[model samples]
Target chain A: MAESSRADNRVLLLKLGVIACVMFAFAWALIPLYRVICEVTGINQLVKADAPAPAVAASDLAVTAAPVRLRFDATVQAGLPWQVRPLVGQMAAPRGEFVRVDYEITNASNREVTGQAVPRYLPAAAGNYVKKLECFCFRQQVFKPGETRRFPVVFVIDRAMPADIGEITLAYSVFDVPGQGAS
Target chain B: MAISTTAGHAPHEHGKPTGLWRWLAATNHKDIGSMYLWFSFTMFLSGGVMALCIRAELFQPGLQFFQPELFNQLTTLHGLVMVFGAIMPAFTGLANWLLPLMIGAPDMAFARMNNWSFWLLPPAALLLLISFFVPGGAAAAGWTLYAPLATQMGMGMDLTIFAIHILGVSSIMGSINIIVTILNLRAPGMTMMKMPMFAWASLITAYLIIAVMPVLAGVVTMVLTDRHFGTHFFNAAGGGDPVMYQHIFWFFGHPEVYIMALPAFGIVSHIIPTFSRKPLFGYTSMVYATSSIAVLSFMVWAHHMFTTGMPATAQLFFMYATMLIAVPTGVKVFNWIGTMWQGAMSFETPMLFAVGFVCLFTVGGLSGVTLSVAAVDIQLQDTYYVVAHFHYVLVAGALFSLFAAIYYWFPKMTGKMYSEPLGKFHFWWSMIWFNVTFFPMHFLGLAGMPRRIPDYALQFTDFNRIASIGAFCFGLGQLIFLYNMLRSIRHGQAAPHKPWEGAETLEWQIPTPAPYHSFVEAPHVEAGDNGVIHSMTGGAHH
Candidate 1:
């Protein structure tokens, strides 16, 4: 009887061990699983897709509508040795109308460096409504020693945006990407 | 072979080792259980000290003693130590002591592994306590250890991660032993359904630990690799999303909450029925409710991350799912009340703590439901309200239940009855001061005082001062508990074989102080011998 119970113990241990392994593997699996869930749910849509935006019809633009205030903000993370400033600090653009804003970037470091810019919306809910048509944040930028450049961001605020949100701040933080050149 | 032969002998036939070596190399379930309990109490005191320090600094909100850096460390280590070191090990110690005796097994299935599992805890706790002196003063990213902030922390973070890994391994091993022992070693005719609620609760809790501890290990391992091994799993600068780390961490974290809770529920189930002189109401439904809670715990992880700006549809899904947990939980609460309904209920120290658990855990549960709404959570997130919500659940709910278990089983384990007056005083002292400390925080949170801040505005000063005073009182009350337990073990009156007349279980059927080998031969369990069901038949047979 003791021998039989020992065998039963062995079987139970093996099964529990397998379950633990499966759970460990499941944690790793959640990475891909999270992406799929986010895609399906339309949450975490910070980055734009690779496909180019469809051309907007001239008639779709609402030029005469009341304008919403737009504030531009830019920052450079530490270790990047770069400065970024929005040429236009703030502006008023009518909803459903395309607007372009310029930003100046200077690499103060002596060596060539690659950097990527990530954008954040102030009233986070506004991220889905602000569609990017043309933005430098889509790809990494490489700069030679002490180089400077100008970039423009073109976007249209969807008319479906809530009326109470009359102002939106678009901010970007540029971080140095080590061991990579511009793509 | 010789050691095995000797260990198998009946208690009085052989000489057990004496002095420090006995504990250092102890293999008996009762010895290890005592060690686990002592270790957890020590950790509980340490964590409690850190909590008092935090309260002291927050008394008037001007950085009185600890700097913001050190305050953050106190908060982080306080959480880590209390959860992993104090509560979890306390439950494991209880399991080690009670499972074999309750189920009529001679020993745990793997005795040596039990010893190793317990010993691993001290080193892990030591690593955490020693971290305060390290550079950057421990991982200050809160207990959740959110990344980017965590990535930039100093050597203390690495030590914290290593400690977490060791704790994870220890938990997983302890869980495996529990599952194996309960599944394979129950006395004859003590079928699964016939088994006690505490055993069932431990079984489910063991499954939860095995399933989630590995996920925690995996997520923290990723954090470790990101710190030194150049992985971009959580670093947003390298094409990775930081929010994903939140997803993975809460995936393990939500179930971890139940891992601490389910055992408390089990412990309460035993005490309520025993003191009320009744069968546990709806034994089958109670089992189903526990299982439902465990399964639902996984679906509700996202409720913690609602402020991370999930889409409205996703928010609604999580919100509704989190609220659904209240249904099974309500079933449990109702069952506990139903057991006490119209019965000869007595308010012993254990019963008082059990009744206290039901009342306050509901308060905590109701607050949890209030925070489940994504719309409401967005406003209340990271506020003192959230702090009040969990402490209501954890300190009042989990810690209260532990006190009940210790008092209820004190006689059985020590062969001496603790002072009833002293135990009752400890309960009331803790209960009142506990509310004084945490209840005001709800108002503080609603008024917009953010948590984890070393300093707050002048308007928040009154409540913070009240909370600080309450915290010191609550800390002092535990001293009475410590004294009660020690004095009873050394000098209290000898207890009868069954001290509580209402108690019915295999453990009580045995001699007092419980023999070194509880059952040299497995006790046969007849169908009507089931305590829960037998009580339902109304006690006439006795």
Candidate 2:
């Protein structure tokens, strides 16, 4: 009886050990699995930047609509040592027409530095409707000491955006990249 | 061979090791258990000191006592130490001391592993506390260790990670030892259905630990790689969403809360019936309810992240699943009240704490239900309300039950009786002050005070001051408990085998202070008419 009970104990312990291993694997798998769930269900509005932009609705773009106010904001993280601001603070553009804005950035420090800009849409849900064609945020920007450059963003406010959101604000915050040198 | 031969002549006389070396190399369950209990108390005091420092800083608001960084460190370490070092180890210690005695077994199945599991805790605790003295101080990303922030922290984060890994290893080993011992070592005819509620709760808790500790190990590894290696698991610039980190974390984190609570449920379950002079009202339902709570725990991890912007459908599903937990939990509460109704009840220190747990834990649970509504949770997620809800659950639920266990089993473990007047004073003082400290935080949270900030707006000053005063009184009340326990151990009157007359468990049937080897000859158990196990030979003493 003792022998059999010991055997039962060994088998049960091994089973539990196996379950622990499987659960660990499942935890790791949850990463890609969450992406798939998001894709299938459209749960998180995590618009994949790489996906081919849905063929712009030619009919929607042609509609003559009222001009909407588009505003630009720029801020640099404290440690970046850069002076950055939108060259044009605001613009009025007809809905569905493409528009472009420029932000001027200068490396204020003595040494050349590299920085990246993170973009945010004011109402957050407006992220999916705003498409970026060319933006400084796509890659790192290098600036020589005291050198100034014009960074541009080209986008269209999809007529698909709700009419109630009459105005949209696009903001950028820049952070320093530690390892990469100035290009 | 020589020791076995001498045991034949004098069966009760076994070779006993003495002094410091004995403790260092001990494999005996009782000695290791005593070490675990003492170690847990020491950590509890350390964590309590950190809690008081946090209260002092918030006493008048405006960062009067500490810089924000130091305050964050105090709050972070206070949480980590209380959960990992104090509460979890206390439950493990109680299991080690009582499980074998309750089951009529000689000792734990893996005695050496038990010692290793216990010894692992002190070094891990040292790594956490010692980080406070390091260059950048400790990890201040809150105990949640949300990513991107955790990735940017200094060396203190690595120390915390290693500390967590070591703590996880200790819990896993301790849990496995519990699972094996309970499954294999119960005396014959005791059967799976017949084991005590504490052992059953320990068994389920062991399974939960095995399931989730590895997940904790996995998530921390991801954080490590993100810091050192070129990985962007949490960095959005590198194509990783920070919310993914919350997903993996709450998977382990939610069940971890129940891992702290289920054992408290088991402890309170025994205390209520024992003091009420009645057989437990629904022993089978209690076991089933505990198992249900564990099963439901896994389904509700996402409730913590409702405000993190999950899809509406995901939020609704998680909200409903979290609300369903109140059902099984309600059943357990009703059963406790049923046990006390019409039974000649006595109010001892343990009974008082047990009653306190039932009432306070219900308050915590109801607030939990309110928070489960995703709409309401959006407002309360990171507020002082969240802080108030968990303290009610943890300090009142887990900590209150721990005090009750100590009072209930103190005589049996130490062969001494504590001062009843001091014990009652300790219980009442802690209960009143505990409510005073946390109750105001609910109002503070609803009035728009966010947690984790060292300073608050001038409008929030009054309640913060009230909370700080209550916290000091609550901290000092524990010192009285410390005095009572120490005074009892050294100078109080000797205890009888069964100090509580209404007790019916196997532990009460044994000799006082329990023998070096409990049940050298396994006791025979048959189910009595009450559906409670009574040993034929063991009950002869009655």
Candidate 3:
């Protein structure tokens, strides 16, 4: 009888704990979930896709000048096994204008390096670009020892390139070169 | 003087089991439940390993060094194995184990069929595993096996189809058994209303399985026929609509989601009151809520397909229907809170996990509500947001509940107390690291990062990088849990007759190191009608 009393009391306490916590979690999540629902249903469009800014200076889509002499300061990655050199330089272009940049590479590993140079476009947080021509991404690139090669990329910034989009950053890593099964 | 031992007063009935043998061999209700619990736990760990593999590969991205195809396989296998292998089986395992245990029955209504049902699982798992070696690779199309792409895969597709068939057969058999058991096996005094919450949940889940496992089976069979027999169920060129497959699939697939989660609801209901010191707050409502969710599940199938060029009104209907689920589900959540109100709460390891399960599972649930809205789902649907959302539910929601169940019941299973410190450590690490891992994916996903892509545009890097680190931590945290399970099973502190300081259940009535044939002569159960133990007198319940 004594043990049974303890069991009864304990069950009541546990039942209360579960009920309280479950309700709290449910209520706590309701706000965010409702926001999500609003976002999905567009009933309350509280969250909007961040809009890109339009160009201030480069209103024109066409480049006024031909490809001028261009060069970029280059450095190899620290302790990096591969040889990499930037082959493109900074340039000014009108809004909605297209540009190209290149990187040269040589395989430093004993094995052949073959993979695409995956490009990451960090477009000033407000601009967008479409890559029309590319070498070595989602495809493959192969470099043997002392094999010097240039990887070229062609891109166009939309007229919506935000006025603040002065620095267009492109970061590339040669990857999926089918290395050891370390991953 | 040599005194002969009296038959009625042997020292704890040495060498006499409490009918646990039936759980091992006989196709009975009690035996099946035990088998399901054990099987699900084992698969839970195995699927955990697969999750770890995904984390390891994505730990750095840039092919930090892994096969791309194999990476795809890991993500695919993680989903397949967890769905078909871990969560599905675990629930079924619970159904097999508990539905009978709680329902006041000697065995499942169909005993031999019950044995046959469980036997299907191992072969299916083996076939799924064997696909990894199938010449080119495993089924790269994913568990969904969306056609054209699925049909394009090589011989391994055959193995995947076979595995699905076996899994379907297993599910169907389990469901049939449940339906029969629930309909036929109630004791004289037990009415359906008087049945345990787990039984109620089981009844609904079984109905779902019967309805949809066949649809899934039928779909896979068509895939087989398409591949070998020239049937064109999903072939557009052959006048079949690929979208029709999606329709049929999500039709089965939507309810299938409830099929996995509703049992979890049942489990939490069982566990909370045992530890919280309260009666289950809304027993009848919980039963109603479960049934409502199941019925609503069928209507909400199209919600998953709104972004697939569905008509506007259809999408609206789906959105409204999907959002309505929150009502009963809210009731359940309210019920759980009611069960825990003002209770003298203690945090035994099981209770800790139960608390964690409630919090984390809610996060997943709310996210589910988020996607149920059609517009937000359009952006969030295919992205890492969806990935983050579902994983939160499955891992934090379903899997964590399973952990709590283990902590609560491990004593009865093995007569040992897992290290409390270790279990707590495991719980905190997983809870912390899991959030660290999955929370950021929401932002990345909202920022428009699509899932299943090997690489992403550079702007999404910071969140992905943070997510990757969290993934690694989450993966590592699981080791603590795995270690606890192994260590406790082999060498933990010896358990007393009742392990939890304040647990009350039929299972706890047995002695420590529960005899094998427990309940051969069933204890005259006298708990209140709704699984709350009010008191009964028996020693060791032999």
Query: What's the TM-score of each model vs. the native?
Result: 0.86, 0.87, 0.70
Candidate 3 — which residues are off by over 4 angstroms? Answer: A1-183, B1-35, B522-524, B535-542
Model 2: docking quality category? acceptable
Candidate number with greatest TM-score: 2
Fnat scores for every prediction: 0.58, 0.46, 0.00
Write the residue-wise lDDT of candidate 2 on B1-542 in tens digits.
Answer: 11111223332454567888778876667777888889999999999999999999999869788999999999999999999999999999999998888876666766777889999999999999999999999999999888978888988999999999999889998898788888877766677777788888998999999999888888888898888775778877556778888889899999999999999998988898888999888888888999999999999999999978677889999999999999999999999999999999999999999999999999999899999999999989899999999999999999999999999999999999999999999999999999999999999999989999999999999999999999999999999999999999999899997999887877887889777766666677775322256654642211
**Candidate 3 residue lDDT tens string, B118-147:** 878888988887888878788877667887
Compare the candidates by DockQ and give the number of the best one.
Answer: 1
Model no. 1, DockQ: 0.35
Question: Per-residue lDDT for B1-542 in model 1, tens only?
Answer: 11121245554464567899889887778899999999999999999999999999999968899999999999999999999999999999999998887777777887778889989999999889888888777989999999877777988999999999999989888899899988988777667887777888888999999999999988888888888876778877566778888999999999999999999998998899889888888888888999999999999998999888777777898999999999999999999999999879999999999999999999999999999999999989999999999999999888999999999988989999999999999999999999999999999999999999999999999999999999999999999999999999999999899887777776777778887767756766653322332322111100
- Clashing pairs for predicted structure model 1, backbone only: none
Model 3, residue B538: C-alpha shift (Å): 8.2
When summed lDDT is taken over every stretch of 10 residues in candidate 1 chain B, the lowest stretch is B533-542
